[model samples]
Target: MSKTNLDIQLKTIPESAGVYQYYDKEGNIIYVGKAKNLKKRVSSYFTKTHDSGKTRVLVKRIADIKFIVVETETDALLLENNLIKKHKPRYNVLLKDDKSYPWICIKKERFPRVFPTRRLIKDGSEYFGPYTSMKTVHTLLDLIKGLYQLRTCNYDLAEDKIEDGKYKVCLEYHLGNCQGPCEGYQTEEDYQENIKAIREIIKGNFKDSLGQFKQQMKDYAEKMQFEDAQRIKEKIEVLENYQAKSTIINPRISNVDVFSIVSDESFGYINFLQISYGSIIRSHTLEIKKKLDETDKELLELAIVEIRERFNSKSKEIYVPFKVNIGEEIKVTVPQLGDKKHILDLSLRNAKYYRMERFKQIKITDPDRHANRIMAQMKADLRLSEEPRHIECFDNSNIQGTNPVAACVVFKNGKPSKKDYRHFNIKTVEGPDDFASMEEVVFRRYKRLLEEEQPLPQLIIIDGGKGQLSSALKSLDLLGLRGKIAIIGIAKRLEELFYPNDPIPLYLDKKSETLKIIQQLRNEAHRFGIEHHRNRRSKNALNSALDTIPGIGEKTIVELLKKFKSTKRIANAKLDELEEVVGVSRASKIYNHYHKE
Candidate 1:
């Protein structure tokens, strides 16, 4: 593009602070940027001296420029985030992994056993990870199983399989590692206590756990039970050793994110490490093949924001090897010498390792090329912050006026977070109004999120057309969080997927891998909502039959569930067995009604 075109574009822009964009011929996005001063930020690109290989290449393709004017630099900071998600122009940095991570699963039941796997689904289980290393995860699991003798099998106690003498104790029992709960080597009461202690350790309540272990050891020793105290002493020592080995790298820099970058002419790599309460979370990386001044602290701020949001960072302090500005009570300090040097060196190494990893992935991916296309097109379409990594989608489901529920599924880097999935037994809205239902669900979701002081999502995808879209908008506005989140409604136009918020539904080119990725995410969320809705419906029907019995009200129903496990068993119960249950009587009128059916 020429200076005359730039001048023509400048005629309508404001003399304020915000972000701007440049698009090439054929309407492809070429560059994305933010400005502390909108007028000055845009004007500088046209300056004759503002010439570099990167700038010149971008400027040459520029067919037109667009700008967003805001109140201050900070507003620009936030608006830049929204625009990046909306537009995803080709030139922005994306710093998160797209693959779903692994989580350690422990089924929620009378006897919970921990198991390790990458796949997570709704199975009434308590999940512990999504931790980075399988080796580390397995090692820890093995230690707990070996030392504590906890059950590692997936068999449910509810299945009437608690016959202790029937099954042989596994090798873990011989190693004195298993509690032998499976073989009745340990009393059920004692096993439950041990499980509670293990749970405290898994939850990082190490202090309380250690204290309890110490008390047990001391009590045994004082009672002249020297052998028992010695064994308990070993367990306490193991717990203490684990805590000691997992030391935080830095204590002074609380709530900090340290970043490092390594790049060359063909590919650039960015490594981001987030530290909360001082422990170093494994570093995350992004590769940018397209050239940029992105290594600078100002641009790095956007990447840092993505990292924090992706991990749901709880830290308030962010330490960077280079300087960058951000929110919270954050201090961005650059270390010049001394002890900080080792950390900076580590960050650089992390960047180098990541760069090499990307180089390997790029042999097949062409990451920079894909990034260039996505970033450019995204900005034009969405008008975003920088790039959208942590996008969350919401959907409401019901079956003919029964079992109303809403699902809030989070997608970080184009994949769903099963760990973060939420089910809302929607209480505020009634009937089949998707609009009012959506409005109530969205409001309830964000209102509590805001009160809890969680940051809003970059973009929110709702399932429906204008009615659903507008309902979401109204709820957002009512809660005073309208512009804080971008709303997109997915609607079906005739036979095609349509986003009604757009002037026209976006139709991806048939060969595009990116569209295939988005489609998978949308489908996953829909399946999740329907499955949760169906489960609730099934449970409600089961309970309805029991709820109507003469002696069985909601409370008695809850007690029966707590004891017998499920309605299937209750429905099939003989009068003698039902009468044997607590709060149940054989002569009660309920017995007559149940048997008559």
Candidate 2:
């Protein structure tokens, strides 16, 4: 398709809700999107400037455009989700789940067997869940088994077979685990009643089951059947215990799905919590790799549709942190307070934990990818024009205006480059003036880097407030490198970041990865500066004490120190030991000086 033809198609596109597909030159669909207004959404792609390189590339790849108009925005969303899943277009967010989840299945048989399965067969059987884990399925199954006497056999217990006496009771029946449904001991009506209660239990509704059990126990107690009453009491306790563990909020907040997201530059983690009668019946997190720098709202909307379909959820209501468009069929509630907000927070926490776990795994398995993500995150968080792959932080250390020194710590790809760390001895600055000290080092560091043709850091950090930042800026201006590198100052009081010429300081989230890396750099610079200052002070103290001795030149002091390791050791050394290291004349001068003191 030519550009002229593409413009004509865009003009013809209707201003209505629909799904659109962009095809590449090879006639393959590259992207699929949902829009409330097809014309406006599709036209914006071509008209607006995209920040993400991938989005720009996707736009340039378009050789043709095709769309299907839908009756409503919700329909458009569903269509987009299906088309993306079917075609898996090149520029769509990738949904990466491949593991088969477990489901509790009620078989379609004479005496239906309830068991956990990973495969779903369309045989008119009822499958309750595609649970997140096998452990949850087993736990529910165990609770059901403890509460009810159900058949767990594969025998054909037809009326004719029972009449002919072909099937017999198994060991499960003798062990009191089953009610002998294979024989005539349990009728179909009685078995169906138990099945109905089990269905409610599986749906997380325990009111009816608890009421029935309490009634049975009361009747047994009235008849003086103490053992039977006690057994019934035990079953009630089991059901209550299971419900207690599963319930998280008010029981009235039922049949709702809660979703929350924690996202980064490359991926979005959306956690879904299915609430049935205020109990969390299902919990899962979906990881979606971004293709075009999708927003959290967009990712959440798409993931809500995908996860609900995958989990076979028919929940009519959902709790979210913000409003979303996913059709009016399901009520979307932005929870603000009370139990609803708590559940939403829980979903967010789960998403954060999942993201953290993925980061840990990727750090070991794909380190380059981890570094790229951190750099990207820092770039966005700091509002930089490019990723800060190389960063340098400066800190000044001086005790009582003595031995003032500045340290510059280098970080490559968000980790310390210890070999590149440098220390400045505050040569020009006569006193403990941090601002002047910072200016001198900043100028000297970059001047030498330029002279040696070494690469300059993308970012520079000054460990002070606006005054220090302004001082560093003056140095950059003198070096003709102002605005070429991103620089900020950090104040110790509140961890506030001061940008040059900006009075309003930026405060990053304390827990964010960007802030953590920045804090690490600042601390490293401080420690490195303190260490150098301490060494300079110690060297000056040693020189002053040894230089006063007559005929003990720098060479003799060096040789004696090398042999004795310290001035104290030299003073304690015997005459022969000192003579062996230095000549007898210098040894006598050093020993006599220390003894006189």
Candidate 3:
């Protein structure tokens, strides 16, 4: 544990490519790393100056060392990644709770039962997915069921068992969902043909099944069996539809592993997209917690090795955004353009989106920290003097200058406070004047809050550009609150955020959490305003519709609506039905009004 002991221990390390682990006094692995020469790499920690502050701290805590020598650098890289994942060392890029996703398995048995499972037993079973979504697995299984009559029972229909009549055809066979392989009614060779087609379909190659269906259709048509031909044509259409939905990239870019990474200060997200016959067969993103200030290249290399080994990838080449030292067995390409670059970009987008989703999940799980981070980000991004903990957004909605309304949505601690949301019917603004409507709503909302001596929002978002923002600012000025609260307007056209007296709008990254929160505010206010306006329009329509009936009064209309439940039901009611409800005289007038020839 002493410096002299550490120096003495380093002398025993091998001078070969291998994985090394550094341990603390507690005998727990503090770091896992791969090096070409273990002796030199392990000794360099004590011998050289480290620019990284984390490295210095890690070296100070190292009390012991362990190494695993491998034949090649690639093996070392792989072993290092695996050890890091399994042991979850304190100083390595590790994905937390990283469980293998589900795969659709076709058990290599008699009748070959197809189902979705997480386990991958190497018993000659054909596994398809390792899919990112269980829904995808269920979808493929459902599609297979719709296409072919495969057995679902777990009966062991060996040749001897079938010959001895050990099993009977069940309800599945009677329902035509299974081909009764248990009774030997379906020959093994014939059943194997269906299994072959299914294997191709699950592998993202639908051409074989489609071709066979087309051939079957042609044969039926030639024999003048038009119904059978039509059925086969329908089968071909289903295959084509599924194929069109799943296919995304060029078919020529096949059997390649594509990986992209996006990292922030504390964490890195690595997205892996597996392409087979031009379709993305597997798409997954991994979240890595950085123990040190690791570079993107380091994180990416570690992830690629871990992912490929976990997925059992046999890809001879990998498409990456930059070069990685993964060794000579698999080629790593940094594609500049074309489909290769496009695929890489797609993978990057997945990583970005995954990072965003993880951030959201974290916000839900750790509200206090997430709120602190978001408020800090907002303060920095918006150039506000303080964190806008309680924020409000306003939107105006009016269709064809009728029933103009406004909505005020509140966000408390980076989340919507639905109970505090307010809706305004534009009484002061006669027409569809959004600027005037915005001014009226803003004046009404804040004036009441100030009168009641209630807390006010730190930031206010206007759902339009300069005009609406200027209108809201006037209201704040009238309330002696101008410059007291931060206000901005977001233009619908380009998501440009406009500030008071600032001509050049500030453009935040479209994927930023701050932008997403602002967008959420805008959308919520718009939806609330639209809903309020629709309710007004519906009430007005009902009032005007009943007013047109000469003999029917407001009370009668209400009673009729209450009984009939809707205007359409009232319109469709018989003369006698209306009479039974509202008396003969009023019912005849209402019936005549509706049934005018």
Candidate 2 on 54-160: residue-level lDDT in tens? Answer: 98999989999999999999899889988987898989986655449999999898878889999999999999989999999999999999988888877877888
* Deviating ranges (above 4 Å) for candidate 2: 96-99, 215-234, 542-553, 567-597
Let me know the TM-score candidate 2 reaches against the reference structure.
0.92
What is candidate 1's TM-score against the reference? 0.49
lDDT of 1 by residue, 1-597 (tens): 677867878766777777788888778766667776677667766666643577766766788887777666666776777666677776665434434666667767765777787776787876664566777677667656644767766545542465635566788778765756665667767777767766655544456667887998899999999999998898778877775665345544444667776655345666776553344534567565545654455446776766665545555555566766665356666777754655667777888777656545764577565455444444345556555556677777777877778778887654567897777877877676677888888888889888999867777877766677788888888999777676676665531334435556555554344445455556777788899999887787878877777655777777667867887776666666667664446225445765575
Give the better candidate number (2 or 3) by TM-score: 2
Model 3: per-residue lDDT, tens digit, 1-597? 888888888988989999999999999999999998999988998899987789899999999888899999998887887787789887776654445789888899977888989888989998876787998888888888888889988887889999999999999989889878888899989898999999988878887898898999999999999998998888788878887877888887888999999976567899999998888888988887777778899899988887886777889999998999898989889999998999999999999989888878987898797788688788888999999999999999889999888899999988999999999988887777989999999999999999999999999999999999999999999999999999999999999999999999999999787899999999999999899989999988977887899978999989998999888899999999999999999999989988999
Q: Against the true structure, whose lDDT is highest?
A: 2
Q: Which of candidates 1 and 2 is the stronger one according to lDDT?
A: 2
The lDDT ranking, best first, is 2, 3, 1
Residue 357 in candidate 2, Cα distance off native in Å:
1.5
Q: Give the CA lDDT, 0 to 100, for residue 454 in model 2.
A: 98
Q: Among all windows of ten consecutive residues in candidate 3, which has the lowest summed lDDT?
A: 91-100
Better TM-score candidate (1, 3): 3
When superposed on Cα atoms, how far off is each prediction in RMSD?
27.1, 2.6, 11.6
TM-score ranking from best to worst?
2, 3, 1
